[model samples]
Target: MNWKKAMTATVAISTCALLMSSTIWAHGYIEQPASRAYKGSNALGLNTNVGSAQYEPQSIEALKGYPSAGPTDGHIASGGVAGFGPLDDQTSTRWHKTDIKTGALKVQWKLTAQHATASWKYYITKQGWNPNEPLKRSTLQEIAVINDKGAKPAANVSHTINIPSDRSGYHVILGVWDISDTANAFYQVIDVNITGQGTGGTTPTTPTDPGQPSANAWSPSMIYVGGDTVSYDGKTYRAKWWTSGEMPGHSDVWELLAGLQ
Candidate 1:
């Protein structure tokens, strides 16, 4: 071929390659606000650790539908918090997982706007807890922040966290500080989705679920009491309600939530 023709062809191929790469990169990302709140019994959840040596364990909890308030937000119920805080300084909640390969690092939950302060803390250990001190509370490594100022049912917000290479297995603690003088604030925890962060370098194993169909898919949708159904395109699917471990952050059992859709 003539030089002019060859050069034209090269440019066209390069442009197409560049476009394809950008599309792939843009498509991969973890999204919060999991599609559909969990259904079935209240006993379904999962746990994930943060940082370098991160890992996860499966378990179960009897989660009622996503917490709601006087009114409603979207399909979920709504409520407000004034001046309420945890009775015990040390507290615990469920865990959500993310795939670093996909560059996914967003965490979200439901809460009321009345609460003035919303924050996400991370930790390898519980805060304010001490063997000698009866009031020793558990300590957590603070990683991200959330803003919930009103009591909107399913009011949602998200934040990015710092996961140190050395820190393994991370969980998000959703807390609401005092609102006005009442100091009573309310928060709800539900579908948390981790996407995009799978190691792009390796061949990932598709997640699987037994009772459910094998080819399920997930979208930017959420299910409250009745799960939002989707298809799973990965390997190794497991589900359960995770809890505080017998050890600091360890647990057993995969309660067989639902297969990935």
Candidate 2:
């Protein structure tokens, strides 16, 4: 009877350890826009020196409640995991950027192991934040949040969130997926370059190409991009890149046109 009891106790301890190990390893990453983790994977190979994340793209699990109780500043991109520490490196060119626009965006996640969810929140680095330094909460502003109410998300899930029209230029988006059943959440950072005239609510005028004619004489106040043409003093001139207030033939930025009759 004593020998049988000892065997049972050992088996119970081993099984409990196995379960804990599996639960702690639950992970996932953003698919759409291609998160830093997803980009670092062996499958895509968008980045190098990714460390363990290259083999396990979804392994960035961290404590729940981001910005308040989550990973430390400067390490948010890596979920504060030592093995994935390379992701915490910051630079304007450190990570590739996804071209994004203002308004509604569809963000998708590839969950290798789904769990009961509490909420999935998204935040973006505020405009004028330094790109050469590690990301911090003070530089981020909440963009969207989805409350899942402890329901198990699908193996693949997408959320439609509206990006504000005030953000422009380079920005970093931080996504946090809170697991209702665990003490952890998955952290993913997405680098993006925003275009379009934000807050202006007006369509950005397309730059005139080589073959397009200028509507009128170049105004000193008018901004001109490459390939923009203007007719001034009975001659046609082509302007290059922000050629404002410069006479068509006086500066190298404007070239005299010969083919137009």
Question: Best candidate, TM-score-wise?
Answer: 2
Q: How close is candidate 2 to the true structure, as a TM-score?
A: 0.67
Error of 1 at 136 (Å): 6.7
User: What TM-score, computed on C-alpha atoms, does each candidate reach?
Assistant: 0.27, 0.67
Prediction 2 global C-alpha lDDT = 0.79
The 10-residue segment of model 2 with minimum total lDDT is 198-207
Inter-residue clash pairs, candidate 2: 226-241
The lDDT, on a scale of 0 to 1, for candidate 1 is 0.27
* Candidate lDDT (C-alpha), each: 0.27, 0.79
Candidate 2 lDDT by residue in tens digits, 132-222: 9989899889877666557666677666556678788888988899999989999999988888543322211233454656547777766
> With candidate 2 superimposed using the best TM-score fit, by how many Å does residue 231's alpha carbon deviate from the native?
58
